[model samples]
Target: MHQDFPESRLQQLLPELIAFRRDLHAHPETAFQERRTAAKIAEWLGRLPGMTLRTGVAETGIVATLAADKPGPCLAFRTDMDALPMEDRCGQPHASTHPGVAHACGHDGHVACLLGAATLMAAEPERLAGPVRFLFQPAEEGGGGARVMIEQGALEDPRPVAIFGLHGWPSLPAGTVGLRSGPVMASTDNIDLTVHGRGAHAAYPNRGVDPIVAAAHIVTALQTVVSRHRDPLEPAVVTIGSFHAGTARNIIPDTAELHGTLRTLSEKQRRASRAAIRQVVEQTAAAFGARAELQLEEGYPVNVNDPGIKAYVERVAVEQLGRERVVDGIPVSMGGEDFAYYVQQVPGCFWRLGVAPADGSPGVESLHNACFDFNDEAIGTGVRVHCGVAWSWTRKGQLC
Candidate 1:
């Protein structure tokens, strides 16, 4: 840890932080509809003196800025404030109060950690050499909130030289942090395909071209994009999650619609997979005596971490939590993150903070699971790491 980190003050503040996290978890919101969540965050940050608060940015997003008497380069930390549309099966008292909405992805804990950092930093303004911006982003679950916030100038007017963010990982034990250099997450693309064919009665043998048959062939052929078209070493996924066809068995439907997602780690691979999919769908449909239409909806790009920033974060984590708790060169994940948008505009690093059970126990639930909850024991560790990085950067300057 940096010599200036106030360990005693952090211990004193941990209880309130945990309670705040639980409260957010109990009353969860999803996507751009985080009005209550934003209000709660704003209320908490408003208590601290000398903090500039901006509300309603990008609709249900908030940005809080804190500066010191001394002048230096500004740094930013972002926390997502959206929940998933799933049931809360954790069975805890602080579990979700809303039906079909839960904080299963740990965004609540993220908000608490950022708030804790802001509180501690606010108390010791003399220690800061520059301003620190806290971004409360909304709609990270497929809503593209980060892109909208950037368009509205969340990164401007004392723009940060570098930004940082973190997500809770259940695979690692508490107090440990995972760091990787490049391509930490994959790019996401939504695919919608419609196979068109002639409709006819069941008794008529040659009256109609059955699109269901063509759609089935298309689904089977799409796998070839990943298995044969792309290199075996490269990672890619082509899943047809939804398939809809005729309502009754006796009638041949005119069309069949298929919806799915495509994931790739590199832009080159993304392009190759897309082309392969289109070719397979078109040719397969033509062979079945039917026509098809394909549409691709682009999503978040691959999240690439800045090498220098990753190194800086690793150094800070090792100092604060010891070398044993810091895991370097963790494998890249196929999951997607909107934080990728922020890094495209400025140098940034997004890492994983361990959140599994502190005790050595079995049956740890993975993220996005209904029973998964953010472990409170990891909040202090996250706060310490975030504060360490922000303080070290503001005082010592950029590493790269």
Candidate 2:
């Protein structure tokens, strides 16, 4: 017999969830290269009753639908499936076996949690008032998987009325959940630039235009785009993370390459910043007697949370997990999430689940860190939260 509530059943299935997370963590896959990961997910999810599986969407993504006994609008629970291109330093027995690829962003835990919720819902489909969709997305690490999935019709055939997603956070203690109202994350845009000039011996610098010098000046000048060009009150970041030039100390290279990222909170600001950056790069290079080329690779848009939906999720979280474990009005982040695309299509709420251990066992293994690993204990918390949100939403009908 199933437990009276979802939390008890999630706790009972904690061992299985932990095993699934560890397996996924050990066999890491990055971006659209999640074939093995997708297969494993499909295998586990296929066991549930009333589940209809769709594979190969967006190359290596999976969408599983579970029908309810009664008819109503569908809801979605989404999680990423891709790992990062980084080494695992956690040294756990289940640490990534695939060198240079690891689940540093806690995506393994996210997948396990969503699957656990699916299991609970499947155990007693009669409890569900409507159908639910499980989105096992791929390529979240700078690949725009959600946008690709949308383009490929991941949301069609049984489009959900609203969706929910969660990320694991190290800043908060385990069992706690964080929420915010609007603009939860920033937009991401990448910049590629090349400065062209004449090459000559360093000792005879006067004989040729120095692209290195032009690139240096350009980098320094781009700093002003965030400071003087954009409104200080609005959040924006311009960082030149990579620069390459000069083969030898004695030679002034003919071309220098620069790579960076631009992050902003709004579309208008994003466009304005791109224009300003292009203007600064070309003009700055010209001032140094060099030519410049700039390519702005557009990325995920700002992630905005619907207030009414967020409030409803906040209430569900508070009810499932005690008030002490729920944090409202959490600070907005500058990071980007492809889930922004899904919410852009439907009203959705993406929140944070705390996975930090109390003993500080693996001190500060933050997201994207090579040494990072998901806290297994938090798996149950995540599972319960997702299950609670799904059951509450399906039973109560549309909250807002």
Candidate 3:
């Protein structure tokens, strides 16, 4: 590894980094609506010499490839650029400028981190042997931005042998890197259950089929998919996140809908649990004299790691960010991510970059919360970690 380059350079670029992030944070964009954000990023990336810019591959997504004079394997580093529909409560100077649209998911910080890496690669061109692909993806907040990019040929051409991406987590310290070898995140799928019941007057006790009653049954029984059908050792979660029933208590509504997500770390569990839920919802609703309409939407897949690439990430985190802050083999999370789509196509590893409070005064605020913001100080460290991994993975000779 090259030791002459210093992290001090990151401080010099901080003014622009912080400004870019805040400006984008203020004018937050939702999935597929990141035209301004995409333009801003493309403008910044274009300033860097020797990098070929490619935009509009997947609906406002931007990809820039940096090639070295010498040839080696290609490695891609990705960052999701999108905002959630939460309000900004961080109260920081760079707080969300948009109303009702906030960067509560720490995506703003992820973009800054990848940009930091790009600056470093630009500075130390001679040291990098293989090519580095910088992916500033859009629609990561909820839309399937990652899926679109891959489908549009981001991973093709050089066809990166290994891809690496990271999520900003608030559970760990500001500069800590949380890594796992396999099944790091759970698969997420959304199913909406609409129960068709006959509407009738509330005064008549036996006039109509009570959809509220049927919905209660469906909700309660779906939980059994995890407790009864799945193994105890294996991780599984089926949560009914939303339910909309009768509009007025006096009148029994004809239709009631139940919406929720199913999370699992294993593919077998995902398939089995989903099938079980469908059957249970249909059967349970049918018994109550109501027909069921179910719509299951596919979401992020399980974030699994490549054994070879995962080992390299550990080494990079320790050397760049320090060993004390680099955690290994943390328990997997139930949250789903579209990054799984990319991992499915190639050998890759997805890890969490922790940015939570260490003193316990202001502890972690789970992602998608309005108060969440990525620790800006950690941006430089993120760059070092990515470069270190790229070098280790694509270098001709390194720790094996």
Candidate 4:
């Protein structure tokens, strides 16, 4: 293992990094409204010598670059900055101050880890064979922040040869890293459907078309797209999260609205499932003598880790933390991640950093839960992994 940043140095920085993570948790911001969060990050990066800061990219994103003396490929490390729009019930001293907004997904810890890496790299810029770009991105929670950052030229200006990112995984024990080669996270697409029918009096049965009945049928039939239409081996989800129809119990409403999400692991499945959903909704509604309108909003793409980049990350991780600490072939998740956008543009790898309690405690709160908080114990490991990857990737003659 190449110890560019010694364990003692990383241990000394852990307290400050934990404090920063807590501060971010306390003052959580969501989506593009991360002005204060970006400011705090900018202030921290500003103090590091030889770091170039660019704020306000894609509304609330920030990119800090540290260039090496010799020329080599630029490698990018990304961290998300937005919090989820949910209440924080952790009851920690640094619990979220913002109402209905919290860092329940451990993005706060991600930012702190990247910042720690930046601090170490900035202190010894000569070790870098090329430039290292630290991307503090906003709006990872359903806002597609990664796409916006790319559109705003965050990847340009000495474009990076590859990108790397990580998310906290509660299922894995702390200090372990989970690496996968492809389709680690699924693609997310939204479904908005409206069934139109003629209103009728409750007392009269045959007077008008019933949209409520049609909507019920539509929901039930949509499941077939996942179970019967797609291959059983393939993973897919069609969930109707919201359904609204009649305001009063006495009358049949003229229209009913249905809102749901679609998740698929492969593009072939995604496209096929979408077509099947539209067909099912329309044909089922037609069978009920009702007209249906379906709208599909494309969300993030499937987050695929480049095979070579994944191998590179795995090597660095195994070197930094022992082979036992580095886990391979973690199960794929149905959850969506905007990091898919970055990988689509450049060869990138997004791995999982374990945040579960190291002491083997049960009942660790899962992500997006009201009481979920990032494990502070994982800070040192995360920082070490990020720094190790950056250092090794930026070394001369390194290829990812």
Once superposed on the true structure, which residue ranges of model 2 sit more than 4 Å away at CA? 1-4, 68-70, 359-364, 394-400
Residue-level lDDT tens digits of model 2 in 1-400: 1134655666679898899899999999999999999999999889998998989989999988898334877888899999999899988999999999999999999999898889988897776668888999999999999999889887877778888999999998788999998899999999999999999989999999999999999999999999999988888999999999989989988999999999998888999999999999999999999999889999999999989889888888777778888999999999999999998999999999998985656564889998889988787778777777777775456532
Candidate RMSDs in Å, in order, are 1.6, 2.1, 1.9, 1.5
In model 2, what is the error at residue 103, expressed in angstroms?
A: 1.0
Query: What TM-score, computed on C-alpha atoms, does each candidate reach?
Result: 0.96, 0.96, 0.95, 0.97
Clashes per candidate (backbone, < 3 Å): 2, 0, 1, 0
With a 3 Å backbone cut-off (N, CA, C), the pairs that clash in candidate 2 are: none
Per-residue lDDT for 34-53 in model 1, tens only? Answer: 99999999999999987998
TM-score of 3: 0.95
TM-score pick, better of 2 and 4: 4
* lDDT: worst 10-residue window of model 2: 1-10
Q: Which stretches of candidate 4 lie over 4 Å from their true place?
A: 1-4, 68-70, 394-400
Single out the weakest 10-residue window by summed lDDT for candidate 4. Answer: 391-400
The lDDT for every candidate, in the order shown, is 0.91, 0.89, 0.82, 0.91
Alpha-carbon error at 152 in model 2, in Å?
2.0
lDDT of 1 at 125: 73
Tens digit of per-residue lDDT, candidate 3, span 138-236: 887668889999989999777787889998887787778888888988888988889999999888838999888899999999889988988888899
lDDT of 2: 0.89
lDDT of 4 by residue, 355-384 (tens): 999889964599999899999888887888
